[model samples]
Target chain A: MTGDGAPRTLFGKVWDAHTVDTRDDGAALLYIDRHLVHEVTSPQAFEGLRQSGRRVRRPGLTTATMDHNVPTGDRSLPMADDTSAAQMRALERNCAEFGIELHGMGSASQGIVHVIGPELGLTLPGSTIVCGDSHTATHGAFGALAMGIGTSEVEHVLATQALWLERPEEMLVRMDGSLGSSRAITPKDAILSVIREIGPAGARGAAIEYAGSAISEMSMEGRMTVCNMSIEAGARAGMVAPDEKTFAHVRDRPRTPRNIDALVESWRETLFTDAGAERDREHAIDVSRIAPQVSWGTDPGMTCDITEAIPTPAEFSRGDESRRAAAERALEYIGLEAGTPMEDVRPDRVFVGSCTNARLGDLREAAAAVRGRRVADGVRAMVVPGSQEVKRLAEAEGLDRDFVGAGFEWRESGCSMCLGMNEDVLGPGERCASTSNRNFEGRQGARGRTHLMSPVMAAAAAIAGHLVDVRGWELAEAV
Target chain B: MRGVATKYERDNIDTDVIIPGTYLKVHDHAELARHAMEGIDPDFHSRMEGRSILVAGRNFGCGSSREHAPIALAGCGVRAVLAPSFARIFYRNCVDGAYLLPVEVGQEAYESISDGDELEVDMAARRVRNLTRGEEHEIAPVPEIISGIIEAGGLFRYRVPE
Candidate 1:
């Protein structure tokens, strides 16, 4: 905060206070309040620490889990994939060696690191968090200044609990209008809509705070879903100003700061941007006509409304040769012809688990979508909960039964089929409706074409065995 | 820092291209190095051949927060990477891990130097000499703090208890 009584951006207040050392070149060393680690990016960092004989300087500040490579089914059985087993084993070994708490297989706390953080209240309004995984930006939902750090920076945080960061340019994304009459609009759609308007590099080198009525009315899970993909827009992080809803959502969590909960609450009240804070850029999205989004191209930004048609290369007005070439290639890879209706676009698989959409709320929405319908034949459909707790809660409510009875494989929790690390993957040349972030080539599997949609949309696709508009479509068909 | 350059012209060359996720399972540094830039250039390892310097377009390291991109670059014998701009995390990783020197040169320099051009970099002076072209290009700034970290030989050595 400036001493002269100037209004500060929410990012400014948190960032300025965390600046421990500022260099002449404007690079700042900011202290990390919390560090989250996952399997893939940590092994090399731990190795570097071992060579240096340095213990984690603040063990209490760091937490570890195995998400990206762990299996989401039948945990009692040994992992069939040898390399994945080894990666998970490496995380367990590194965490045990370093005295950091790990929530590994079968642990109640074990889940996607992003899911577990807010549930445990570790992600607070005024904190700064860093994780080796890019989706760590999800924690920014509670107004925390969270950003992804590379493994080397991971090691730096472990050694000193401080990371060198340059302050990012600030952008305000005001989701102006409501989804209007479309009650089916999900946060996944809202975010996909944002990405569509502003391409992948839209918010690069910036910090984004999502505002407007749509954001305010969104649930914590919805906010999580939105912030989880801020990295997809190439933003350093995305946040929502913590309001009463955020306060209520985080109030009684196991890790909510009990001692400082009140003090923190008071401090959080000051974290919102003032009326006249300077915003480097602002984009107002009038979402009245926005529908549940689906990406047809190779990237998240190449998207259209569910009612829209698959765009031809000519639809891309951008004059860049490389971008046009990339779009044309994506259409070829996805096997979607130009000007085809997005409706009834067939898929070989439907996946509903990832940090982006595997939460309980997502499950409930999906369960409602396929309550009494069986998956269409020849379409492989599966449901892997985001966390063990989500799975347990869903099972307690028999949401798992609704899915299993509907011919969906109700599995355990982890990042399954999201990045296609383990056995869960799409077959060659197969198309899938996925509720995961990122639609890059082979993201779901080798040579697999992915269509990014909401969990409910994925469920609808699985039941219909094609891209069917869930909008106004009857949930159950007559016998 | 000086070496002949192995050039890649595209922008947003992500880590997935640096070393694909499939090869990430293999731990051996040399093995990883073998696959570095294979996504973009299958013969990257053969092409680099210990050239020790890399020249590329803007946002050289873009997606996925993996230091393996730089680690694989280093393991393949790259000493310095010159780019007009770089993804933030990748830039920090270059300095923190002591993987390679990241020199921020101008776009003119990026377009001027071709593959196999020998180059000399003087960070203190903020310029690069294209020995092959017998010309010098003024680089944009490398953060003073970053230079300090590089001089101290990476983060681990930089913070050694005095």
Candidate 2:
């Protein structure tokens, strides 16, 4: 239904529908359907609006939350950090002045912006969503054209509910083959493997359409975990074609449209890319070959299978001196030798949460891993759910008890320790097996080493006291 | 515009390295300035004493959408960053925010330009002159809308057509 009878991609269809104006150079004014705001990036934006005498154009479409700096511990306690307290107060004042609804720190709805958007159903299929935080791409799991914008664009959206943008070229990442019968292989692993195959900036300037059997078979939460890390692969946005699973996930959410079935029927017609639509580039990966991946170096691309040893600088030096130097630096910073077996790298801490793997399914995976096992001595571990709702759901399922009984800290929801903005952070020189995206130097804390992995892998590392392959956990425990 | 370059001949120099997350709470330009490039170079402010341009490898500002990266750099008096390529969001952020110019250079220019080289960039001519080395290089032409944004001094100052 591209009107001209030519095949169109999902991205093309969404772009055409939301374009308010187009220029000769292909730049178009895009109508933003949803704006998810968090404290870290919105202060300057709201300050800009106040200075310009501009009110939020459509406050109803905008939602604010305190996530980036909110401490996950004891909400009732006065925030000991005065600077963080001021930032939170600024957001509350701005939201009040702008008349935008805020899911403040104590609100049950308060959580990571990306997590609550989908949970509340603000992120709908075929909608264009933007947030200042990079993980805004997480909403693309529902087939929304979601992207992360900067504070300037955030102000633009607040002032006009639109953004001027040049459409990104489309890339197709066809994920063929099964992830196998074992539940150990997760969406986190699948995406880490994809980032390894494609370098960190592999999908630069393009939007990726994840397709094929593996994506189709993934549960909505799993698909979200995959889409959330799309930004880490250097794609501004990544999405899967919405289908029954997407609709079913939305069917019972709080913000579904009044005419759900009718909306879905229309979504079915236009939300999918036509069979012969052209892709600017195509890449394929067999999901069956994907194992639980662990990042050894500074970036996500420096990942390998849990069973593989840390690679040497010479391995990266083949025609790329920059990569080789980066490798050498990463190895030195991460405190690992090239030939060290991944299993030999014992973590000082284990973090089983982040926007990437903090959903209900992810919690269930981690709980299953540590149901009866105790955390290793001298290793500190914690699980921060993606949202308050996820925490409530996990507690209802006794997952909290399992984590606490196994000596893991079960905390409230926020982006805790993921970016280390709050009190939860790794001490200097402490190495952690983290489920968060980005293994960049000091991502968790200043001079902290991060090894990115799946929830199960992180949980196993907590019990085993090292980065052990989750696939071989049962055998190792039996022996 | 003419300025000396501070070169980092590497790829994927992310925003976290440009401005660490710990300083994200400090929105004041002066406070943020003290921490510019704190992750990669603890002495970045001192290093910025005479330099106003940054020359780097590919994918500069490749992580987080924190406008603080460019803001911190601008606060520290960095007017432009020249790289072989850039991450999309970062490029747009620079132009839209008018914090700094993110110029895309070719392999030849990237290799020829050295740290501490005196250079003059002419946006209108789409050319760069390495005065210290007596060499010149062509830069990718700024897109039509981007040039307009630059002329207007940021997106807020520019008017979109109805």
Candidate 3:
């Protein structure tokens, strides 16, 4: 089905299929297959549409939810923050006026836009998905060409279901070796390590296809975690070539296509990169070498292995004085000194949630680590499920009980403490071991320090009261 | 266009720093403007007053698709941001939303442009004139599609020819 008879990468195939038209400048009008809307980004976009008096082009294709600004605690009470309440109400009203399906705050399907898209089967392989949130790339784990758009593009998509964009260059990020051998290296660690290697802008303007043995061996949830942080490396998007694991994850979900079997067969035939296709850049990472990564500074790239010491400004700064200055500033803000061991830095809190790691698998891993253990004294910890559905499933399996039994707060679902748009925020100067993505300055709260890690690592940090490595952690009886 | 520059000579000035996540729920342009660069510089709103050009290091606006970032900067009267490079989504949002200009300059220009340097950005000539320092620098030529969209005033006004 490759039109030009040239071997095409999966990105090329998906992008080409969705091309509505192309201009001379190589800018293509891409038909969007899915549009995921969240409260924080959609308000202005909806307002723009309302101002223009335009109805949604394809209401059925658009799905809305209240996530970013929705409070994760006590759904029964009225939202205390008026601005957040207004925004949530705006989303509800806008969805109603536009006739778009909204998974409201209390709806079973309501959760992080990225999490619910996959859980409900709205995200399909070989599709083009766009959301106003940067982490929309999380859906690329399904092998879709997913990218984040801005509010303006949100309105544009609302009106036309298409937007003009120059084709992104392709990059092949191949992960070789065996993740199975690296027992403590979760997909979160693998991605953090990739970001460390590439720096923040490493994959700028490129859509990355994650290939090689390790990526193939990962579960769908793991793939989602890896793809979720592609934006952190400044990549336009990140994806994996859909395999049987992808199909199995999508099968019989609430929103999957009716002809699932035939679709799977077709996907099996054409969803992968063709032989001999070229990419603008290629980098191979050995998964076995990746340890549990923890971001030590403001940006995700400012990371180190669990066993490594904090990097000095001179060591990490590649001759750029500005980079060194930034590193110095980050250290000052993070309240850490160079050469300090990661394990020695104590955490004030532990958060196991966000679109990146609040899935059922992630919770199961975290719960296992915390099983029969209590959260260290003075270290507040919480586990928020990725979605209500994930919460339901976790509770059904007694995962919630394990977390509660371990003294971790089992809260409701949303993007809780990820960006801290909701009530689950870190106090100023509080350091947290978090399973979410992005350790940017004030990402969780003003002056809040976030150390990005895997769910198990966060759980262990809760138990140990410090940023301890999760490997070989011994779980004794709860005190 | 001409204005004085307010430079933050550092890389990776992220959106969360531009407009902190706490204020994301408020869509008012003016409200967002008040908190522009709140995370990194609490005095940014005051410091940015009367300045239309913002110069910074590499990878400016490096996190989030909040668009609130460009919206906040633009709301604070920033007409153009000159940096070595910009994050992909932030760059597009700046251009596509017609919020502000994201001008990519070489490292020399990015460094040489000083804070409070009165400057003129000539898009047609593809040059930046440092009026205060009396130096001229070439900026990356805006791509054809981008120029076309800008001329037409953002994506909504510019119709892509089929």
Candidate 4:
């Protein structure tokens, strides 16, 4: 709330800071500061260069890691799966051949591509970043216009440090009021609830800036969780302006300016759009109304409060008939029925990791939810930390013990179970409550049904053997 | 091309569904194309032998910024994708890669174009001629700049004019 529209938003300030030139087409030729790469998408771009006989143009702006296909548990062993092994080796060979820095297995920095960027301070406020991974939007938490690029575009960026981007229509989604204690709302819940209210395409072609009292109060990690899933709602990206929390998180990390006053001043100047700034669309939500949300169908927008029932296709608006059909197909595939209470939807497995919700805070929340409560009998539960550093921190805080004690497999850091590239995958026909981004059919593994939920909700589901209201349990103790 | 259109109508047909994230690791465009739509429709690769265009509802290519999406479609011989809308990244990726041409038509256009309709796409004129219905519908042509990219055979080749 900057008084009478004098308030600058993070989006405006950051966009202005990074804009190199406005083309005749009204698109921006923005310079990217940091470019993250992973095994899955970088190989082709590198091969394209090899065929053309060109070297990586700017290795300084780029960094690479292997996450999408690396086995979660046995880093020492050769990848057990041929596809995973080949992808990992290809990234290693590509990075080596191109002279790009790579964080391989057993490295402290090795983890999900999105997790490592911010942790290493490579993703900074008022900067543009791109990766070949969709969750590249996760970096927008620092008020950067971070986005995912295609393999061809990755080569373009590798050759030229800048990208041609059409400026997206801007939207502001402001939240007010402290979340009610009984709501058990996390940033995951908040984002899911917002997506549920606004259909999947509600923010299409928009660069959404989240603001207001409640958003401002969240930690940098919480803000990251919110921005990470913005793409799920069909928005190009979501951002929260860099504030004291952002400054505090980045100050001690590598690459950030060591000077306190100068950093503060720079961040303050980067806050751009005023509260009343012109926007294509503006929405306001009361934080108190949100609860721990769970996706009832495939898309993130097909979400509801855990206490609610699966929506029948007939209940959908006329415009949503196709979506209703898709939902019906997804429900049928997931072995769930409409009109069943969402809380009654039991999961055979539980996963708590992804670029969307695998931060240290998410781990702590899951640990809290499972603390002193054993996982339901026959339920397969796993807690995969997002980054190596996140794993180390969790171990130092004894969070691993909480998860292990609750009968959950404490695994190494990677994008395990998020997009079944690695060894950690659900069995055929197994249904899981996951803290990942998408719940598309067989996304976790072939014939494995995924139910997207917050980490806390996943933990609650694991303990109860069903989708349960996380708020029903005492949560403060875990936090 | 002569059979009735086997329409697969769905909204938000994301790149992930068209080409899952895991297949991104494979560099061979042809091999990757074989797995296109494996998760969604297991026989998509085989079924799309000679399809000229894919008709769908809103927000096609909605997830992930993988260019493999357009490459996969192109390799599968799909010349055009006509949808009500498209995700910005996927749309740009398709254009930049010079693979698949994305045409934005109205919702009514999708409704009228039934499955198995023999169709011909004209990129220069930006129209889909519904041969079955003897009808013509205009679509948003690829921008001039993007048309140049396609003419040059993808972005890499386009950049090196020589």
Interface DockQ per candidate: 0.46, 0.78, 0.83, 0.58
Better of 2 and 4 by TM-score: 2
Q: For model 3, which pairs clash?
A: none
For model 2, the stretches where C-alpha displacement exceeds 4 angstroms are A475-479
lDDT of each: 0.83, 0.90, 0.90, 0.80
Q: After superposition, how far is residue A57 of candidate 3 from its true place, in Å?
A: 0.6
Best by lDDT: 3
Native contacts, share recovered per candidate: 0.40, 0.65, 0.78, 0.55
lDDT of 3 by residue, A119-233 (tens): 9999999999999999988999999999999998999999999988878889999888877743467888888888999999999878999998889889999999999999999
Name the weakest run of 10 consecutive residues (lDDT summed) in model 4 chain B.
Answer: B1-10
lDDT of 1 by residue, A1-479 (tens): 45877988888888887988776666788999999999888888899899989999999999888888788778899888898889889999999999998989879888888888887777888789999977888988888899998887898899899987767889999987776534367889999999899877788778999999988888899899999999887889898888887887777888777765675668667879888899898887876767889999877888998888887776763776545766787788788887887885888889999989998888988887898888999999999898888888899988898899999999878887887777788877999999999887766766788999999899999999888778875543211
RMSD (Å) of each candidate, 1 decimal: 3.0, 1.9, 1.8, 3.1
Give the Cα-based TM-score of candidate 4 against the true structure: 0.94
Model 2 error, position A362 (Å)? 0.4
User: Per-prediction count of colliding residue pairs?
Assistant: 0, 0, 0, 6
Off by over 4 Å in 3: A181-183, A475-479
> Model 3 scores what on Cα lDDT?
0.90
Model 2 error, position A159 (Å): 0.3
Best-to-worst DockQ order = 3, 2, 4, 1
Report the alpha-carbon TM-score of model 1 versus the true structure: 0.92
lDDT of 4 by residue, A1-479 (tens): 22343545566666655777665555666777888988877777787788878777789889998788777886677667897788788888888888889988768889999998889878877778889877777888888888877888888888777776777788888878766544268878888888878877888878888888888878788888888888887788788888878877777776565675686786676554655567788888887777778888877888888888988876754466887688778788878888999988888999999898888988988888888899998799999999999999999999999999989999888888998877777788998999999887667887788888888889989999999988778864643
Kindly provide the TM-score obtained by chain B of candidate 4 when compared with the true chain B: 0.85
- TM-score of candidate 3 on Cα atoms, chains taken together: 0.98
Which wins on TM-score, candidate 1 or candidate 4?
Answer: 4
Task: Please give, as one word, the docking class of candidate 1.
Answer: acceptable
